[model samples]
Target chain A: DQQVKQNSPSLSVQEGRISILNCDYTNSMFDYFLWYKKYPAEGPTFLISISSIKDKNEDGRFTVFLNKSAKHLSLHIVPSQPGDSAVYFCAASKRNYGQNFVFGPGTRLSVLP
Target chain B: DAGVTQSPTHLIKTRGQQVTLRCSPKSGHDTVSWYQQALGQGPQFIFQYYEEEERQRGNFPDRFSGHQFPNYSSELNVNALLLGDSALYLCASSLGEVNQPQHFGDGTRLSIL
Candidate 1:
């Protein structure tokens, strides 16, 4: 059973447009959510994260919002550039759990000029 | 300073063979986590090591084992490798502090033929 799900297999956006990626989880115990960006042939890199303590977290153009009641989270990137094209994964973990993170299937985002 | 570093960027093995992958954590990070990423899927947690001890593990099989050195580097050993074990293995390092982000290595691509 997949505890985390990213239903969108891929996404496409024009450069300079806003891109939104969605993710959902079945476990209610997850308290911290994170987003990672990965290029082909490379490991996923940390992008942004949000703790259950807050509903939202932002880093420059990337923003993540968590909705505990809905067991869902979404990542928003404004002015998506060609450099932003890659796979984005949403992961969740309960605080103090020692990094036993659960990740979504991943959404490959392609930004076209 | 160098980020998390992994060795043998690529490897190929046959069924029933054993393979070992190595990683060196970023300077000053004490916690190391391992993940496996299959094609078209997000990475999955394997286990974590801290202070030269295995702190936590996920649902992976006993065929997957690991060790951490006093210098904070880590190694992952897989015995009786199966074709299902073919994936890109990633190593990430963190401070083990509550809510700290993990820095990842490029990963070692293992192909079980």
Candidate 2:
């Protein structure tokens, strides 16, 4: 069973506009959510994360919003830049589960200049 | 400090052959996790080693196994390889517990013929 899912396989946005990526989880035990950005032939780099206790977390141009009631979360990039184009993956883990992560299928985001 | 490092950036093997991949965790980190990413799919967890013992595992079969050394480095061993095993293998390291975020390596691309 896929515990986490990213419904959109790909998305495109203008460089100066906002980009949003959504993710959903079927497991209610997951309390921590994270987003990672991956480039071709490279490992994914950590982007932003949010804890269950918080509804939102922001880091620079990246922001993550979580809604427990909906079992969903989203990553928002304001004024998206060309460098932001890559595959984005959102993962979830339960603290009691000993750090084993469940990752979504990933969304390929393209920022058009 | 160095991030997670994986050796043999690429490897090709024939069916039924056995292969081993290595990983060196980031400095001062004590946990190591392995993930497999197939074409156009998100990574799926294989297992995690901490304190030189297997702490957690995912849905992977016994064909996939791993080891953690005293220095916190890790090795993933796959036996009786199948064409379906072809994928990019990723290693991630974190400090202590599930709360800490993991940093990943560039990954080793494994192709089975």
Candidate 3:
């Protein structure tokens, strides 16, 4: 069974707009959530993260929101740039077991110029 | 400083064969984790090594094993490779602390013919 799920397979947004990607998880033990952006032929790059204790965390243009009660989380990138186009993966891990991560299928986000 | 580095960007093996992949963790990182990512799916955790020991493992079978050297580099070995074993193998490294985001390598693509 997939512990984490990213329902949308792809998304498109024009530059300077907000791009939102959503993810859900079934495991309540997960306390830390992270988002990674991957470009073609490269490894996934760490973007932003949110702990279950907080509802939101923002880094520059990237913001991650967590709704523990709903077992859901979302990543928002405001004023999206063309460089933001890539595959975004949502990952989750339990406290103290942070080395083992469960990842979602990923969403391909295209930021149009 | 260099990020995570994986050896043999691509490999091809036939059924019943075995393969070994290597990874050098990012500088100052002491933990290594391996993942298998199949096409159209997210990465699935294989196992993690810290302090030259296997601290945690995923649902993968004994056919998948790993070793972490004192230098904090790691090797992933798969025995009796099957066609199903074909996938992109990713290596990630991080500090051995809780909630640390992992840095990943470009990954080694294994093809089983």
Candidate 4:
């Protein structure tokens, strides 16, 4: 059973537009959430993260919003650039349990110039 | 600073063969984690090593094992490789802090025949 799910398999956005990627999880015990971006032949790069204590976290052009009650999170990239085209993965873990992260199927985002 | 580095960018093996992959963590990082990424899917955690010990592991079987050196580098060993083992193997490193983001390497692509 997949504990984390990214419903959208792919997304396309024009350069300078805003791109939004969504994720959902079934486990409520997950307290830390992270987003990673990956390019072909490269490992996923850590982008942004949000703890359950806060509803949102923003890093430069990337912002992640979490809704605890809904068990959903979204990553927003404003003024998306062509360089932003890549696969984005959402991962979650319980902070206190020292458990490994559970990652969702990634969403491929294509930024068209 | 040099980021996480993995060895043998690609490898090919047959069923029942054994393979070993190596990783050198980012500068000053003390923790290492391993993940497997299948085509069109996000990475799945295999295990983590800290202080030369296996701190946590995912649902992967005994066929997957790892070792961490005193220098903080790590190695992943897979025994009795099957076709299903074909995937991208990723290594991530981080500080032993409570909630630090992980830095990943380019990964080693393993193909099983």
Candidate 5:
């Protein structure tokens, strides 16, 4: 069974617009959530993360929000640029555990000019 | 400083053959984790090594094994490879600190023919 799920296969947004990606998990043990952006033929790059203790974490144009009660989290990018277009993956891991991250299927986001 | 580095960018093997992949962690990093990503899917954890020991492993089969050197580099060995073993193998490195972000390599693409 998949512990994490990203139902959206793809998303498209215009330049300078806002892009939102959502993810859900079934494992309650997960206390740390992360977002990664990947380009074709390259490894996923770490974007932002949020701990279960906080409802939101923001860094520059990127923001991550966690709703532990709903077992859901989302990533938001304001003033999205074409450079932001890529596959976005959501991953989760439990604290003090082995630090093995569980990733979702991913969502392809395209930011148009 | 160099980021996580992986060897043999690509490899091809037949059924029942054995293959080994190598990784060098980022500068000053002491932990390494291995993951497998299939086409159109996110990465799945295989195992993690720290202090020259296997600290944790995922649900992968015994056919998948690994080793960590005193220098903090790592190697992944797969025995009796099957067509299903074809995928992108990613190596991520991080500090031993909990909740630290991991840096990933471009990954080695393995093809089983």
Candidate 6:
């Protein structure tokens, strides 16, 4: 079973607009969430993360919102830029077991200039 | 200043053949985590090593094994490979192993022919 899932295989958005990516999980044990962006032939780069203790965390133009009870989380990028176009993966971790993580299929964000 | 580095940018293997993928964590980092990403799917965690010892493991089977050296470099080995083993193998490193965000390297694309 996939503990974490990103339902959208891809998302298309216009530049300078807000781009939102969503993710869901079935494991209540997960207490931390992270988002990573990957370019072709490259490893994923850390984007932003949020702890279960808080519902929202923001960094520059990126913000992550978590709904613990719903086991859902989303990442938002304001004023989407062309450089932001990439495959975004969502991952969850539970500290109970050395913070082991489960990742979801990524969503490819295509920004149209 | 160095990011995680992985070797053999790409590889082609046959069924039953063994392959070794290598990784060097970012400077000053001590923890290494391995993941496998199949096409159209999210990455699956294989395991994690800390202080030259495996600190955690995921659901992968015995065919998939790894070793970490004293310098925190790591190698992932796949034995008796199958066509299904084709995918991108990624290595990530973190500091302190506390669910801290991990830095990744450009993965090795392994194709089974």
Using DockQ as the measure, which candidate wins?
Answer: 2
Docking tier of model 1: it is high
Which candidate would rank higher by lDDT, 4 or 6? 4
What TM-scores result for chain A when each predicted structure is judged separately against the true chain A? 0.97, 0.99, 0.97, 0.98, 0.98, 0.98
TM-score of each: 0.98, 0.99, 0.98, 0.98, 0.99, 0.97
Tell me candidate 6's fraction of native contacts, as a decimal between 0 and 1: 0.84
The lowest-lDDT stretch of 10 consecutive residues in candidate 5 chain A is A92-101
Model 4 chain A: which ten-residue window has the lowest total lDDT? A93-102
Clashes of each: 0, 0, 0, 0, 0, 0
Best first by DockQ, ranked: 2, 5, 3, 6, 1, 4
Candidate 6 ranges beyond 4 A from true positions? none
Q: Model 4, A7-58: lDDT tens per residue?
A: 9999999999999999999999999999999999888999999999999999
lDDT of each residue in B1-113, candidate 2, tens digit only: 78889999999999999999999999999999999999999999999999999999999999999999999999999999999999999999998765788899999999999
Model 5 DockQ (Cα-based): 0.87
Q: Model 4, B71-104: lDDT tens per residue?
A: 9999999999999999999999998876788889
| Alpha carbon lDDT at B79, candidate 1 | 100
Report, in order, each candidate's fnat.
0.73, 0.86, 0.84, 0.71, 0.80, 0.84
lDDT of 5 by residue, A4-113 (tens): 99999999999999999999999999998999999998999999988888999999999999999899999999989999999999999999796889999999999999
The residue-level lDDT of candidate 6 at A99 comes to 55
Tens digits of lDDT, candidate 5, B40-98: 99999999999999998999999999999999999999999999999999999999877
Off by over 4 Å in 1: none
Lowest lDDT sum, 10 consecutive residues, model 5 chain B, at B94-103
DockQ of each: 0.80, 0.89, 0.84, 0.76, 0.87, 0.80
> What DockQ does model 2 achieve?
0.89
The TM-score obtained by chain A of candidate 4 when compared with the true chain A: 0.98
In candidate 3, what are the lDDT values of residues B12-109, reduced to their tens digit?
99999989999999999999999999998888999999999999999999999999999999999999999999999999999999999999999999
Docking class of 6: high
The local lDDT score (0 to 100) that residue A78 gets in candidate 3 is: 98
Clashes of 4: 0
